[model samples]
Target chain A: SQELEQSPQSLIVQEGKNLTINCTSSKTLYGLYWYKQKYGEGLIFLMMLQKGGEEKSHEKITAKLDEKKQQSSLHITASQPSHAGIYLCGADWTGATNKLIFGTGTLLAVQP
Target chain B: GAGVSQSPSNKVTEKGKDVELRCDPISGHTALYWYRQSLGQGLEFLIYFQGNSAPDKSGLPSDRFSAERTGGSVSTLTIQRTQQEDSAVYLCASRPDSNEKLFFGSGTQLSVL
Candidate 1:
């Protein structure tokens, strides 16, 4: 079985500051996904990374997967109050099954 | 129709009662999944349905939990003799066969009293 561990379980940052959240897996990652969830709401898809050393950005948010494929990071530039929520990283372990294993999640609080 | 939809946005049930949660995936999606999210915790995979058959159900926590999909469109998750530990938000997701991205529903918040 594989597990994902996220660093900085909870973080509080100023609205204009920058921050980074990391997700590490015990095994090599085949497919990695990032999602955001508001309180008591469903998750919204953010980005997905497949190949190792891959990087993708949406607006001010950027995500990178390491060459080893065992670690990934999400970076937010000029954070906003709207970025305050739980960010989760999900991994596709088997590739065939749509079942994704998720990390405990990082709670981000961007103070205005 | 546009995205995954779950029924009974909130459910409050007493112990020893049975409850069923429904999920309606996006039209034409062949892959559907069910996950549980406890308070302050990550999502836990419960089951996956490919079309009308379930190829993986190993994530189910107990025998008391069961789910079924019919006609490759709708899914229902049933919990028998619900326990307090069963309280959580059940989320449903669906994706097309061509991609790995999953579209999620608002989820059903279940409170077992």
Candidate 2:
């Protein structure tokens, strides 16, 4: 079974500060996805990285897949209150079913 | 639908009772998925439905859990003899195909007492 581990299970940052969240997989990553979710709401898609060494950005957030394709990172610059949420990283481990295996998630809190 | 829609945003049922959750995926979507999220926990994959082929129920936690998709559109997830541990938010997601990203529904919060 494949597992995903996220570092800094919870984070608290002051507005305008920058922070990074890491997601590492036990197996090679075929496809990596980043999603943000409110406390009890559905997830909002952030970005997807398939190829190793791929990087994508949206607004102040940027996601990168390491060259080895086993780890990925999400970076937020000038964090705001709206940035506070649970960040999850999902991997497409099974190519056939396309079911995603998600990490425990990193809870981010941006203090004003 | 514009996106995946789940009914009964919240449900409260007695233990040992059965509950059914519904999900209406986006039109033309070929794949639908069910996931569970407990308090302060990550999402757990429950089942996967792709096209007319047999669904992948490998992720189902137990025989008490079952789901079905009709006409490759709407899907229903039923939990029999629900227990207290069954309390969680059941999320439904759908994608156009295997290679596309998924769109999630608001989810149904179930509380088994």
Candidate 3:
């Protein structure tokens, strides 16, 4: 079975600080997605990176996928209080089933 | 446009009881998914439905879990013989297709005591 491992299970940073979260997979990832969940709210889709060595950015957040398709990273530039949430990474499997396996998630807290 | 909506924001039930959670996807969306978020298990995928196609039940943890989608719009997830481990937030999401962006519901917080 495929699995995703996320680093720094919990992080707290002062506002305007930079932070990075990492996700590594034990199996080759076909497509990777990043989501953010606020307290008592549903997850919001952030970005998706498919090809290896691909990079995508939304505002201050940038995500990168490794060429080997085994690892990915999410970087936050000048983090804000709004960036505080539980960040999760998921990988989609190929074929008809096409189920997504999610990581345990990284809890991020950006203080004022 | 309305995003995904779930019913009964919270549920509290005794162990061994059965509970049902409902999800209303956005209009015209063809793909819907169910997921569980527990303290120990984190967030786990449960099942996915795409239009009239057969649902993928491989992610279900046990036989007590089942889900059904009606008219390709609304979905219901039923858990029988619930245990304390079933205490968590059940989230629902829908996408235009299996590989498209997902819009999630606020989720139902289930508590088994």
The candidate that wins on lDDT is 2
* Residue ranges of candidate 3 with Cα displaced over 4 Å: none
Worst 10 residues of 1 chain B by lDDT: B47-56
lDDT of 1 by residue, B1-113 (tens): 87899999999999999999999999999988899999998889899888756458988999999999988889999999999999999999988862488899999999999
Q: Relative to the unseen true structure, what is the C-alpha lDDT of residue A60 in candidate 1, on a scale of 0 to 100?
A: 94
Candidate 2 lDDT over residue span A6-58, tens digit each: 87899999999999999999878888999999886789999999998999999
lDDT, candidate 3, B7-41, per-residue tens:
88999999999999999999999989999998634
Error of 3 at B11 (Å): 1.1
Which ten-residue region of model 3 chain A has the weakest summed lDDT?
A: A92-101
**Residue pairs of candidate 2 with colliding backbone atoms:** none
Which is superior by lDDT, 1 or 3?
1
Q: What share of the true interface contacts does candidate 2 keep?
A: 0.67
Candidate 3: residue A85 lDDT (0-100): 92
Number of the top-ranking candidate, with DockQ as the measure: 2
Candidate 2 docking class: medium
The order of the candidates by lDDT, greatest first, is: 2, 1, 3
Greater-TM-score candidate between 1 and 3: 1
Model 2: residues >4 Å from true position, as ranges? A94-96
Query: For residues A37-80, could you state the per-residue lDDT of candidate 1 as single tens digits?
Result: 99977798999998999999999999999999989999999999
